[model samples]
Target: MTVFLIWSCSGKNASEISNETLLIVKKIEKINVLMGSAVGSSGHKPNQYENFEELKKNASKQELITLTNHSNGVVRCYSFWALALSENIDLFSIIKDHINDDTQVKTQFGCSGSTEKVGDFFINLVNPKDEDSDITKLTPDEFNKLDSLLIHKENNLYARYDAIANAVPTAYLYSKVREMVVKHNNQNALITLSKYKNPHDIELILKNRDPDEDGESGYFYTYKAIQNFPDPIFLPFLEKKLNETLDNDRYDGEWLQLYMAIASYKNQKSLELLTIPFTKVKHQDIKKYHIKFVYEAIIVNKSKLYDDLLWKIWQDENIITQEGFEYLLQLNKTKTLELSKKELNSNYQIKNTNTIPKINQSMFSQNLEENMLNFVLLNDKVFAYNVINDKIINTNVNDFEMYCSKILELKDPSFTEILFKRLKNEDNPHVYLQIVETLISFKDESINKRILETRKKNKNMNQDWGSEALDEILKKNKIK
Candidate 1:
């Protein structure tokens, strides 16, 4: 008891401590001491406690009220639950006022609700009666106060949002919520109104769905609203945008969301519209977007109609990458692999012609040299600077391994500097290890000296995967 008192007093003077503050300090001290005792008894932390009921029963109403305002959010949250269990009416106003505190509190499971807003949690505890019923528990004055807060434009966005969301179950302030949705076109208000299945809210969202002068569009939320309501009336607007995107040869960034919204209908008309863009679009970007969404839609709806279309897309060398092929394989492995074999044989043909095919270079050339080096290393390929073609060509192949095999197969000394540079600056430990392992296979005394120097430089610093990699290489080679 004295240890607890001394620890609490050390932080703040007894003269400055209020009765409310002292109560919280004492409660925390008791909990800590109890935890210590439990640890001592069991030699392990106790998950369940036998004294939890006693602890709650002992809490005074006044002290609980005071604890709600405590600097420690966990203490405040515990006080909230205790007051709720005790059915203390006084807690209502205090909980409502502190709804926006935003202090993180931990659950009984020890995970913190850092991402959750406190106001949302407080509103859930209120549990007002259903929409048609009269306010059963709250006084008329308190009920009116909640209604005012729900539509108060000046209040915190989350606070007002929570009020509207919670008010839905009780149907409290329904008219005011509709009015806010229409008048303000507020995103949160629209979301709430959509939940109630109001047709008018859909029209409002479409009417207000224009991009700003800065080309910033709220179509993401607009698409979300349309998905919630799922009205056929909105299909023309969506189709028109899709057509515009196709015509302009550029994406509006919300293309994926729009495509998904269209596919959500799962109807002949919507499916037909979705297939139009996929079949007719030659633009690789548009093709990629369609492939991704179409595959997702097929998986979601379990539709077999798009199987042939996905296979066709997978065969298109310009549209699919190694990663995309892997993803397609996951969706349907047998069909994907069968298609991939045919496509790979044709695409990877080593031609003697000096004419390089006009492919989209931007995709492969962004990190040109680095990407080329990676291709050569990982794909067991070689590049030659063809002066006539004015492009690099894949010239040879060897077995792919990280260590001795890769180093022994390197016919070009030009790549050695590139490998060393990558090894020196590479931050990823696994990659660093691969490079060190490859360099070790060279068995060059000069390279070994450099490796040892690097080891010495990083030795006194933090031991990471990079340092561990160096140790493995040194151990394997029997080097000091």
Candidate 2:
């Protein structure tokens, strides 16, 4: 074990450990951080749920693989499950054996969700197999270990929790987790969570503890015992949310605690009530949240149900407004991008050259290029640029640079003219600096004209928007 640990730990700094080991370390360190241990004694104050984030950033691909094979079954199980979350089947050949992709059912969670079964995921990778066995397959014994952890009462809380999550891989897990809450005697814990005033918590309590069920006090009492222990009882809560998004049914989970109470307890009829007032939800912000999840619930239909909300939002004088665009951007990027494309293209159906809404088309045309660019800008770019660490920042800075370069590559006469116009006086140093940085990514000297013009403007103005903004832009441009 010592030799193997040393071998896996080689070819790495404390900074560059593989993701598998890093995840294991993260799990252990999270416990340490929670326990206020000396292990993370660098004066770092761990955020409630964020302590493992940095270790996740520093972990490598192979280290994650190694951690999956850790000597401790608990460690192996934890890392095995993490891979299911972070990776698709393609990341490692081993996943292919568990997930056949052809035989799985279309669960409420996603399309062909059966083929991407979480049970198959953990079952295949949990304990691995004979030294001579194929990488794509695992033995029956290996699969059982994962199952036993969930169905068997002997396994610890973490193992049972992760196992059940792997087992159902659906809103069905809600029932299983509820069962576990009882098995684990978590009632007092649950009651405490319910008493909390926050909506997200009250939402969670009402979600996991259904009011309609009478005998649940037994289960509730069990859960209350572990209230202060800080187990992630929210797992099934998150799963219920993602799964109830199956369709634009009357009772998808989007209406807060409504879906949890229904789906977690097998009240299939609740789906009907799930979607009431969607069309009638007139408040822009509330309507936006409804449509965001409603769209997900109806994603299987492509745009059949989406068209309803889209048309209503687009046509309603009261509903269709900029306030909802933020919510729309959060739902499905593919659908939103497609909608933007359609609205931009002359041949596309939704375009309104009539200028009915009086959108800011002249300042920035809603062409595909500009719309997509603005979506990224208004959505994630602010957070990405501000995040100093790789974990929160996403690992693809260069890819983002390339993607932004593609936006700059658009040669539309209007778009190009606007680039030069904005570069000359763009007050947002961050946005302007991003433009300069992205322009150079294309490596085309033709853009040099734009840069030169901006520099000329930068010199003559004798400093406009404070020296800090100038300093920022120059820093991004690496200007002398």
Candidate 3:
């Protein structure tokens, strides 16, 4: 047991190190080696939860704070988690200094593992709603200083806003932040100022909008602020900027936000402007997605004009098949059934697997038989099952997993027994898991027995992520 001590007592008369700090240092070392940042049991590293539980039980606040600055990024992250769990700790004071700490830490949630910065990890840990949220525990001084601390980095803007943007009605804080915004032209500060909803700040926000920053950094907060404090006065500016983004053929997350802000106005003309991209956008990928957003906006507004436009686009096959089918089903049953059969029969060879097939029933009725009997008559059990089986056998298709997921959504009982038998044909863990899920959803009596039999034959399935997720899903559903 390496007794790593926090104190440096070299002199002969120096006091001995306390047992509390000594124990904390040892636990921190253990956590550094054995623990990864994870919440659930499915993907947790060995002893990850135990190490955190030990720290939560025995760690002194000062000792945890000392370890939070440790040279190791993972150590800092775990220590921060333990410290934030304390109910009485001033959450903002503890986190304010490390707001820009960019040390990356490996994290696991469920079956996925990802690498994220320590600062981002810390914010997410305390930012969720509940007793431990940072918002519920901030002090007056901490709240006042939040505006200043947030302006230091563009990356930290949204998080900093969440921590302190609760409309505390602090004139001094607002004025101080407004002056800082004017002097530095910080685009991030716009979100914080948006809570005030002052008309004077609108021009300031617009003046700071950088079209060059469209796809990169600052635009998310700008559009988010406009969405939060929406006004028709900002409409012309949003329209002009959105048109510029479209004309330049720039596509990104920010471009989505520009269109979303235009949609928020709920004006017929603004909604019609959104549909213009569907007709003219050159990229099919971009056009498909933007048209979906327009459809959603139209549904929200319940506008018949744009609804008819979607029907026209779907009939032309200008949009994704799923979106086209959704529009077609609303007004024309015969056409929708014809299109569904056409899509199911379309030859999906491995050579054409550039992208996963986009048809889904998640947006439509769960049972195809009830809604489209004519389509499901020949297509079900015989046609659709054969289509899936052919795609599954051709492992070179690369999108067999999507087909399996789509089958799960179809929820047809005819595919259940066949899927159980054909499960062995798929070697990909992701595809295998989807088949298992679809089988379980059927609630067939022999699922557990079949699963055990298959596992007995293929022992290596236990070693794969597919098997691990399979165990978790079965346990979660209370299936044997």
TM-score per candidate, in order?
0.44, 0.36, 0.53
* 1 versus 2: better lDDT goes to: 1
Per-residue accuracy of model 1 over 163-226 as CA lDDT, tens digit each:
5654553366556667776766665666566666667556776775534423434576576666
lDDT of 3 at 219: 66
RMSD to truth, every model: 14.4, 16.7, 10.0
Error of 3 at 177 (Å): 5.8
- Whole-structure CA lDDT of model 3: 0.60
Error of 3 at 328 (Å): 9.0
Backbone collision count in every prediction?
A: 1, 29, 0
Candidate 3 clashing pairs?
Answer: none
Ranking by TM-score: 3, 1, 2
Residue by residue across 366-427, what tens digits does model 3's lDDT show?
Answer: 43432332344433446556756665555343556556666676777766666666676556
Model 1's alpha-carbon lDDT is 0.52
- TM-score: the better of candidates 2 and 3: 3
The 10-residue segment with the lowest total lDDT in model 2: 104-113
Error of 2 at 433 (Å): 4.4
Off by over 4 Å in 3: 1-80, 83-124, 130-158, 164-180, 192-199, 210-220, 228-236, 246-250, 282-305, 312-480
* Candidate 2 lDDT tens digits, 1-480: 122242222224222344454444646534432211122436343352243344345445555556544433333333444454464333344432223222221221111112223334354443445342323334465455445444544432333444443453334334444444445534333443333323444434534543434421223322332222223454454344434333433432324332233223222233333344454554555555665443333332233334445444433322333434434545544455435544323244443342222123332333434444444344444322232122112324343343344455542232343445545765544445555655555555666556756766765333556445645655665654
